[model samples]
Target: MTFSPDLTETLLRPLLRTDPHRPRLTWYGGEPAGRTELSTASLANWAAKTAGLLTDELGVAPGAGVRVLGLRSWQVLPAALGSWWAGLALDLSAAGAGFADAVFAAPDADPEVVAALVDESDPDTVLALSTHPLALPAGDLPPGARDYSIAVRAHADRFPGVPVEPTATVLQADGPLGGDAATVADVIERARALAAGWGAQPRVLAELGVTVRTTAELVAAAVAALAVDGSLVVVDPASGHAAGTVGADEQITVSHPF
Candidate 1:
């Protein structure tokens, strides 16, 4: 149940291959009422295409820094993979907390950037990343980024994995911590044990940022769920923090919440 740095590829990949979509991704977003879904297969293709544009066209190095600009979602997964597939580091910057790259903004984004994969949202919320530019809903877009389709479609449909260097950084959330500190590897390992007790290879995973939750709780739980070929069901913000847990069988652990 212990997770290593290489677990994402070594042990986790095979576990994640629940369907033929292991190499692909899926995303579900919304609150209160559920929204729609995005398939991994679709994401895989998009990631490949994006990787191509970012590397071949834009000339971003395999180990260069590439930042993701949003919270968890189907699109964000592909964007992350596309960066990894292109051999770039993922700088995960919280939307409000500014990073140098995040400060670059959509308007200032250029070929140096691989691409900004914004959520396909209402004309206002993420209209910048949507295919449409005309009619608008009710919201404001953090200017500069383009529609995800424009970025995704600009490249080829296939990309290879990019290697990483020790000094390179890919921001990720760790488990709980003291004050501003985050959890260590040992704690994440213990949580894996707790998950195994409830059920190994969990199917559904739910993570909320409302409080002091650990990233290990989030990623490890998702990885474990995927390990058992289970669907990693993301809990929406509006959905509150409720999830269902079923007896272990085909589904394994029904739900994991952080």
Candidate 2:
């Protein structure tokens, strides 16, 4: 497969190679999940390892389905980028989980739901993410399921993906609130437009909520910040820090506070 420049190429790859140390994301709160920042290089490394785990270990390929469960957090960004790197499409709903080649659930995911899903998903791979900055292993994985921290850590720091078609479906979210699937090319286009519209802002802070994933603007916003040589700050509710606090401390210019 030949390498193609889609969303990851437009946002991640070049950023990693050219401006690797530039801060991309900053998360502030407390304890195990508090005050975290990722540079382009740091985020790329995580995405590459995740891509390796999915493509090499799980046999995920172009057009493969991967469902991500639970709330938005730091982990979702890299994991989503990795899936796109591997040319796999992302699904964010339970109804789509059965057909997904792989499923990644956050540690705070409903235990019963995860258990049932894992039990029903035999040969299919299920990864439970701990979201700890230390990549700590989660306790009590369901049968046939694996810990994302352990699995991803085993992969190399740099896992470049195969060539992918720009038109290939990269994400889908058709729920009651209404959503549409976007191709790699489509997502890139939107990212560019958002970047241009946001002017030359150097930083953006946004609420990390359901809309971030469903609207496909999470990728757009992050890439937009990068387009202007800026950083994206995510306000995670679980962090216990108020939006006002993050905005004040981070000097956030654009945001929808919770």
Kindly give the number of clashing pairs for every candidate. 15, 1
Go through the candidates in order and give each one's C-alpha lDDT: 0.41, 0.68
Q: Where in model 1 is the C-alpha error above 4 Å?
A: 1-18, 21-35, 38-40, 93-140, 165-200, 207-224, 227-229, 237-254
**Residues 211-231, model 1: lDDT tens digits:** 213323444444444434444
- 13-35 per-residue lDDT for model 2 (tens digits): 66666778877888663236567
Clashing pairs in 2: 2-163
Residue 108's C-alpha lDDT in candidate 2?
Answer: 56
TM-score of every model? Answer: 0.56, 0.83
